[model samples]
Target: MDFPTMGDLADKWLEVHARVPNGFMKGRPFTQSDWQFWCTANFYRVRVGAEFVHPDDATDENPVLLNQAFVYRRAQVVAPQKTGKGPWTAAIVALEAVGPSVFAGWAEGGEVYRCSDFGCPCGWGEKSHRVPAFVYQDGEPMGMRHPSPLIQLTANSEEQVKNVYRPLSAMIRQGPLSELLLIREGFIRIVGESGDDEADRIDVVSSSARSRLGNPISFAVQDESGTYTTTNKMVEVAETQRRSAAGMGGRSLETTNAWNPVENSTAQRTFEAKSDDVFKFFRQPPAHLSYKNKRERRQIHEHVYKGSPWVDLNSIEAEAAELMQSDAAQAERFFGNRLVAGDGQWMDMPKWATKAAKRDLPFGAKVCLGFDGSDNDDFTGIRLETLDYYQFTPTYGAANRRTLWEPKAWGGRIPKDEVRAAVEEICAKYNVVRAYLDPQFWETEIDEWASKYGDKVFVKWPTNRITSMWASLERFQGDVYDKDARFRHDDDDQVKIHVANAVIRARGLDPATEKRRYFLGKLTDHQKFDYAMSSVLAHEAVCDAIAGGALEEEPDEYVYF
Candidate 1:
């Protein structure tokens, strides 16, 4: 038998291997030496087709043959380096085109291995060459189709491996390839020396080989307790490298690619109070030295006493006393410093009593009148008082004396004309100051009063917003018991005392019924007062307005019937 030259051997090998079992030769097989010789010796004999091809013949004398050979000379085989484990790497290459004989030789040499057909006995060759033929050895294929490489590694121990691979196999058999890939890629890793138990140890060497060969391989290790202990570090590194490269071109890395510390630690500083500075949610307001430690109590007192815009007690009482005693004899009669006749009962009087016969009313005297209107059978009249009364005076001086007076005291409902006449007479007699008239009557009555009084008599529209009334009551209750303030009247002294007593009692009255009782007391008859009370109660807005300052005092002109 004659031994063939390297070129002849390569040609024969190509010829036999080209006719695959599938009838078409997608690729040809060559030994390492045959490949080298073909690449160098027949460098000019092969033709370069769209892919790679060997020409049928080559001759130096044939021009066409020379061109074809020249094309082949430029051609090169694209042999990618094996990447992963021996079995995985070999199985991937075997699926590509090299003939079964070459695969067998590679497998026997432990350089590569054939992977069995997933389920078909014809092997990958029966699958239209779409699946590469693989090298096999020792009755075991490079890779098995039923249990994946990861599953096989995990199945090392019956007790430890059973849990992981059993479920994994079930999932792979029933689930899609994408799902299987996820489970394999996500959960697989190699075992470190820390986990050397057969159940725990991972075939890291095999996994590393598969990774280097560009095979999609993953491995994971578990402890004897079946807890994952080792992970595929290469996969992590590759992913990181891929993300870094992508980010270099202004691509954003996925959130998963970002590194996060296993334990997050931070430092914080808190502010502490120094010797000079103190921390408090609220600071105390400035203190008045005289009132010093009693600042809060003093503030409450000031708010209660001086906060109102109307009815300044210090000024009004002084002015009223001075004015009433402007004429000496009239002063002697009016300010006699003793109780006399024709005096109306005073309400909200101070604790002290003094004769008004020698008292003098001062300038800028403000007298406020409170009127309680009556129905047909009730007495309709006004009560006048001075804001000039001492809020809390200890001295009982004549000029500073205070007095409250009700001029006309008729009981049964007087005619409107008669009420107007009496009001005019009282204003003329006492030189009346500001009068706040009750305006619960008909609008015509108010128009008449406004036309008559012009501005001196304030026709106050009733209201239920009783802030002023409450404020006035607060002031009166606070100041009335102070001994320095006094009340004096010549006639109807008892009535003045009664009025003062009534006011004192009423001060303690509850607000809901206070106004109604006030109106009832001022009426001519109880029956009529009851009727008027109903009307006043019905007109809550009007009553509230009067109690507030919504209505101003009218002018001081006289009114005709």
Candidate 2:
């Protein structure tokens, strides 16, 4: 109806720049006449990952038709380094500046956007043929109408503007759209006639950003957003832009490098944002891309970098290998496209998922419990491990699948009554051998559990003893990979999420040797891994029990007395 659909607009966009040879194409002039021959943007059309896809195309099975206008208000794309982030962003901005990006009204059947030059018989042909352009119906902006729009570009510094704004200006200055933009002092003015005007300008918002809170921004681009943390106030600036846009039904986009988790960057927050309005595109390395296997890692390197084919694989590989020697985490984050947790993430997500065991565990089964208590900020975890049971399967997807060790439970807050009831239920249903509780904010709950089930099961395993926790974590890592001593859990999102979020940090010296040791932690304060921590202590409980002595099944020598 509106034009063709969003796909057609994308098709038109690719066609329009079809002859605009990228620098990679021998730095040559437009030698080919066909739009496809001149540009590299269409490659995305052939193989677009979710991040690059149009918002209307939400699902592969049923992509939404983009006939009319429905520009998403906010889009946050967090990708690893060296992807075509800059090029694609530049292209999108240019299109919005002066292209058929907005919705015109619905078209009946075969409609075309006729060019105004009647003497020349000019027309928006082929790619945009039979597509609708914005037209007046009731003295309104038919489909997409911004007579004079202002777009702002903000980053950490003026220098950072080069990341997006420089390329953006260049694309308009050199590409077919050059005629429309007049390079002005403070803005690039887009107009039909050759003159600067307030109606349409793309401005680079200042770094201080104190006075930018209430500007009328039709579109805003926050570049290098990974650096926009709470302390920097860049995120607040972006939020202000979003608010400003909302008043005019405008929108904003954030282009960021893969953010550091501990930084709590706006990029990180956007990735974690769980709202329908906030669209996100975060393409990271698959967790299975492990450094342990060289060939696999190389193959995955090629795969993850598909979004940016211009990168020199040979150079990236060499640099990554060298970086791995000193900083594997950095290499992983920058090139491998993996989000690293300060070089101390406990386990790889794909590797952990490989250990998922789709099995059944019911009431009355013997299990060891690990409890991590939280009152408000954090969550409470009640983890159960198999009662030292194993099935020797030498050949499975994951070497030695933990047939019985399954992560079974979790709760949002420390629901005192519910937790007490859960502990009571656990104790009554199973032969609870060891229930290790960390008594932090949950002193009352831990004490109550000890009183109720202490005699039947082991109680609070002091986490303050840094030495013991260090040992427990060490054992747990070993168990994760020992194929013969594999760790596992059910396919519950909570368990998977907690496991993926788990981080390890070297903290507190061993009381005896005065040597620092690693303990479980979250990369960011907002990240949750208390559930996984509970599992660690629970697994540790079993380890300690097995180390001491197996619980002997009390002899059923019941003499009728």
Candidate 3:
């Protein structure tokens, strides 16, 4: 007969079952045979394919008859899959008045009969693979896979087939099956006090494991005695014949939920290799060796020489000694021998200062002026100097000490109008080319001067007070020591020489407090003098610009009124 599609069959089954009284069996009184018949009839609606007819004399009195009836009926429903690659299925069957002994005996008896030459006419009478089995009574099957040697639950009775094997078979047929094999057993146990009469006796020790494999083989023993106990033991056995080929490095193997020995071993090996001290050298080398040796040495040299030596021992000391003994007479006589030295105090100036005063202030000559304003009865002063323009002036008394050029000053203090007037006069007189004016005293006054002078007057207002002062001083010192900068004046008596000497002397004085002390005896106020000193220190850029011949862009037009 042609079978209908699964959809059609399911629909018909649902309709027929819908008519059965729901929960009616709970209150109804029925014999076991009656219940069995009813269950069989309802199950028969589906085409189970197999014939399941009981013998004419089958009865509850004969255990064999009952077993036959149950097995036969189950066989019908335990139908083979139409596609044929699966295990059989069965229903749960309950038994009354059965014990562990009877359960074990039944299984043993069945096994004996099935394995015998004069086989009982059960389906197992023919040679067939022993499909796995599991039994459950109180609880539902845990849905574990087969050929799993570990059985989580079991019962000891002929009904064990219903409790165990039926569930096991159903589970096996459910696809996505594992290759692992499981052998298990089920049993029952009792507990409580001996004299209590009514102890908490219950089922226990329901499952056991027979064998396992993959990476490490394991076996389990489940005890159904008093407090149920399950113990699993693992043994590491090498896979000689089944060894994997070394593809890449490590072997890849299929796995189950259980621990795998091969993977653990491989992981351990990998960890050891990575953590070994021998590999550290390759990972990180010495920092010094990583850089180019010559480059590193060059960098060190540059840093050391960034600032020049503080004193030009060969020239400065010798010249200072020679000039120390001479007065204005010797100075003038020395100037007479030098072509560059001019008349006036320029002769008495230090050799360097004398040479500087003789130098020409051409339009493009590098020039810078530092102004000290008169504040609090202080005298305002302005100092000027040309950079890199030098002329030699001879000193007859100190013939061995040839003078170097130095800076000159054009400054003094009077009234605000006088300061302004003096600045204008200097700007006109000396072609006082470029002048820097202190902006603090009267910003408007300096602005007026700058307006009159145009690009010739540069108003310098200290913005970043401390940082600018420090940076300017550092640059000035650096340029001086490096011989990259020099004062442009004729002699030690020139305004430039006096200002430099005063500044140096002020710096050398020990302050009574942490703050620097400036004597107002030589100026109007200490603060203005300090500011003037800072401006002097800040002239390094002006000096460098002059020496480099770029002073026209912006001259150090610092002027004092």
Candidate 4:
């Protein structure tokens, strides 16, 4: 029961068991491979791409695999579709099945070494790299102590695990490593061992967080986690895995591509949190690369795709161009290795961020209001925009742009009385030209609002159909993209979250005569984009007010009350 340095273990796997069953190296000899997680004798490093790359002292060169005490409990692996993610995860599973992957506790004073000079795996004779494993004598951290750990490959669906599991199953059955294990339906068992021997078996499960109940899994893999969401019982599975592995030193690995903001996948949460416990590795493309700047975009593509040299660049470019015809955001997420919201996004977030500010209009100032909400499971909101949103150079890179403008704000959820009072107060204080209320769950209240503020403001803007929703969304998109349009926000967190969750979709569209106009909505029903909708409504009302000559000087014949 001895082991060597992780570096050597990787070498042994490549030499003995690992193979390129498919791709350019299909049927060819195994080659050298490495993980982005760097380790030295006393330091484990996270390569956070540029500037932030640093290795901390501790968990040094002899890093433990699933060494809970010495490593992050979870690792999030994000890369394009075919950059060896499957092979790498499979390799980990293979080595974990049998290797000195376990930690041998703290080193006592002298060195502890176990030589691989006997019964080496790399077949073609003797190899130089993998050898001299360290044996545990006493008083050492027993890392990966599970000699036959129960590993599970969990995905949102069984089909998703096929890419990783199929190749993994093949590597064991077809490769020389089959001597160590046996593959069967619903189980990959250690040779000659019973189901009771939890230490040396792997299972592939899909969905159903309930299936993992009471199971003590030594390690788990969430495959293609970008699609694993709250709806698919991902949150439940994650919690279950952690609870099951609690104190037993169980660990999990997640592999996924960039997810749409609407998806709100577990991978998105992990990457965004930047938690200490979750080790993340991503080859992200540079932001601010203008679509017009083809050269910069190409360079970003080259840099992000350097890991996949075997993938044809010419083919990628061609495919990328073709994909752009449908969804450029998807093309970026896959080919450019960029973690972006999907093509259904209503607004460019980076463009939207530029308009963020901290401003409040005077209580008596002329403005328009937007109201959106639901009965439950979604937030209710009210937002105000000035009567006129003139175009200006947005706040680009903090260089004297937007010095004078006040940031717009989203009024958060409150009681019905507060909402009504706020509406009445705003109408009384400001020359409220119009109010657009999405009358879904609040039809009665909306009718009351129309009666209370009908003369001063045009208040009935129901978002029920094609004409109503499209009008608002079209004007909003223009306000976002056009430098002349003014649609700024007060940098509210709700605005960002709600907007981030919004996706552009052609709802209730006709195939033949009428061209499809997109409206902003959630990526999925569970995700809420209320604030975004309110913003759209606010913009639409402002446009209406403007069209009604709200911004024009009153004629001498016009009388005021």
Best by lDDT: 4
The Cα RMSD of model 3 versus the native structure comes to 43.3
lDDT of 1: 0.29
CA deviation > 4 Å runs, candidate 3: 1-366, 387-413, 429-434, 455-457, 484-487, 492-538, 544-561
List where candidate 4 sits over 4 angstroms from the true fold: 1-71, 108-145, 156-159, 169-179, 184-186, 191-199, 207-214, 229-243, 260-276, 290-300, 323-332, 338-344, 353-376, 379-497, 503-520, 530-561
lDDT at 40 for candidate 3? Answer: 31
Model 2 over residues 68-90: C-alpha lDDT tens digits? 13533467766666666665566
Ranking by TM-score: 2, 4, 3, 1
By descending lDDT, how would the candidates be arranged? 4, 2, 1, 3
lDDT of 4 by residue, 180-298 (tens): 55788877875322224534677777784346454877777778888877887776676677667654567677888877666677887777563677777776665445432567667
Residue 84 displacement (Å), model 1: 99
* lDDT tens readout by residue for model 3, 1-561: 122112222222122111211123321221222222232333222222222223243355532211111111111111100101010111111011000100111111123222122111112223462322222222111111011111122222234324334433333233111111122343221111121212111121222332222222111111111111112211121121012111111111111111111223221222223222111000111212211233432332223222223223334323423543554222212211111112122112222222333543544333455565544344455555544433122221223321211111123334455455555544554444445555666577777777776654465545235544544554544443343455433432323323332322123223444444222112111112333342353264355445555644555788799
- Indicate the residue-level lDDT of 429 in model 3: 41
Tens digit of lDDT per residue, candidate 1, span 295-380?
A: 43344223322312222434433433464455422221221211111222223222323323224444433444445554554345
RMSD vs true structure, all candidates: 44.2, 9.2, 43.3, 10.6
Query: Candidate 4, which ten residues in sequence have the lowest lDDT sum?
Result: 46-55
lDDT of each: 0.29, 0.60, 0.28, 0.62
> How well does candidate 3 score on lDDT at residue 319?
40
| Reference-based TM-score of each model | 0.23, 0.70, 0.25, 0.57
